[model samples]
Target chain A: AQSVTQLDSHVSVSEGTPVLLRCNYSSSYSPSLFWYVQHPNKGLQLLLKYTSAATLVKGINGFEAEFKKSETSFHLTKPSAHMSDAAEYFCVVPPNRDDKIIFGKGTRLHILP
Target chain B: EAGVAQSPRYKIIEKRQSVAFWCNPISGHATLYWYQQILGQGPKLLIQFQNNGVVDDSQLPKDRFSAERLKGVDSTLKIQPAKLEDSAVYLCASSLGLPGPETQYFGPGTRLLVL
Candidate 1:
């Protein structure tokens, strides 16, 4: 079985400041990790993924994340935040050969002016 | 290329009523998925289909919820005797079903409200 956890239920950041969203996972086998963002009343859009390729993965909207196997963490980060970045973010683990993708609860992001 | 498509962007119904949602995956994509997103939560997989066959549906509430993917193209999810907790946004997604890893493209989602 595979599971993911989003550490924060809500995160508020000032515009132009840095942002971070934390996630951790427990999987029996090597896993595929993904980050998705959802705007108000909109469906989720893929942000980035870590599939055992590179430890550091860059994504759309100038966002990026690092996969740390030792810590079992995939934390999203951005050097600067924008008002438009306010949205709900999810961390997902695609199913392995036998398991299906498992999603984290989610983190609501708020941008302060 | 067109993204996934879903119908009746929104629906409102009373508890115990039945409601159905439809989805059309991207052309040539053989994998389709249906997920439920409640307010303040991440989307949960209700079902997954590889072509016209079921791949996974362990979380689906089979007693009141049913889904089918006919002809390996379009799919529909039906909930009979719906409950208040079932109220949420239903999302449809598709992938190229390529060997290795690929991104899943999502539809706008259909929001359902049960009163």
Candidate 2:
């Protein structure tokens, strides 16, 4: 009953430019949201999480996401992009009190120097 | 602390061949999960184990796929008579059995290619 949709499959940005990866969700109850990054040939790393405590959440590597309940959105953003920031990003949502976590199709961030 | 560990970073076999992937979770973590990630898609949960007991496996293809966490520390996922569609990255993740909002730590994943 809970799912996540990533608006973009791929995004390209020049170095030092702002970056945004959009996501929308459908859940019956208040859900926990997370942003994870995966570098090539590497495992997924947690960027940040929202557990209903805060609407705006900051994460590692100058990344952050804002949880908008009214919009049913949790969009990841960064003020400036770096070469190392190029990776695949995923938006995740876990149904309330459920063990299964649903993930979006993912957005690949491309950094152009 | 060490992260989740998986074996056979890459594997290739014929469509009818069988393959197995292994995983070792972080110390003392009570939950382990197996996920299949196809190209350009997010990882999908194949099975979940809570301390050597099956918690959820609705998505697993039981006729061809099976998994087990015998000792609750390490786990294995096997695919028999594999199909081309089964070619994907098998990721292993583990997490503490906290009540809610637990972070699942992932492994580098085993990439399987069925030709």
Candidate 3:
């Protein structure tokens, strides 16, 4: 079955340090992927998406993701982490043959002051 | 543009009780989806609708859950005789149903706690 994999369950970064959240999709061919952020008791907010266009997708709040087809990865990255950036991030892919989309287990980002 | 809307942001109930969730998708969106999000896990697709018709509900627990989208607009999901494990956040999302499936806009979600 098709799936989205997010290896790290949690990541901690000191304020002003870089951040990385890895995501990999399992499929026979390339599919559009996306990143979304969720804060406590809040709805999800789209960060960025890769739809076979540019390999690098820049999103809101200074976050971005690069789609590497060869690696089957669409890892999210940010140069500097902020306190407000602490949240749960999810990687999503288009619906599979079952017409259901796949969501990675998510990676929780914690920022240290 | 207005985003998806869900009512009753929170609910608490005992096992075997019945509860329902309501969702109103963004105007002009042809597709609406319902998801179950367990703690520390990503959202799982429950059901999907396109223009008041069911597109997918393969993951839905039909024995205890039901959903419908009327007039291709507002939708409702009901769980009868809810189970303790049913406690989770329910999310509603909508898409324009464009050629590429389009981006999905999610609602604030309705959190449920089953005791």
TM-score of chain A of 2: 0.95
Local error of candidate 1 at residue A56 (angstroms): 1.6
DockQ of each: 0.50, 0.66, 0.53
lDDT per residue, candidate 2, A1-113, as tens digits?
Answer: 77889999999999999999999988898888889999998999889988899899999999999999999999999999999999999998886566567777999999999
- Candidate 1 chain A weakest lDDT stretch, 10 residues: A94-103
Candidate 1 local distance difference test against the native? 0.89
Candidate 2's docking class is medium
The regions of model 2 sitting more than 4 angstroms off are none
Clashes of each: 0, 0, 0
On TM-score, the leading prediction is: 2
**Strongest candidate by lDDT:** 2
**Cα lDDT for residue A104, model 3?**
74
Candidate closest to the true structure, highest DockQ: 2
- Put down candidate 1 lDDT per residue, B15-114, tens digits, no spaces: 9999999999999988989999888777888998999999889999999999999899999999999999999999998887764334578899999999
Whichever of 1 and 3 has more DockQ, that candidate is 3
Taken over the whole model, the C-alpha lDDT of each candidate is: 0.89, 0.92, 0.89
**How high is each candidate's TM-score?**
0.92, 0.96, 0.93
In TM-score terms, candidate 1 sits at 0.92
> How big is the positional error of residue B57 in model 3, measured in Å on the Cα after superposition?
0.9
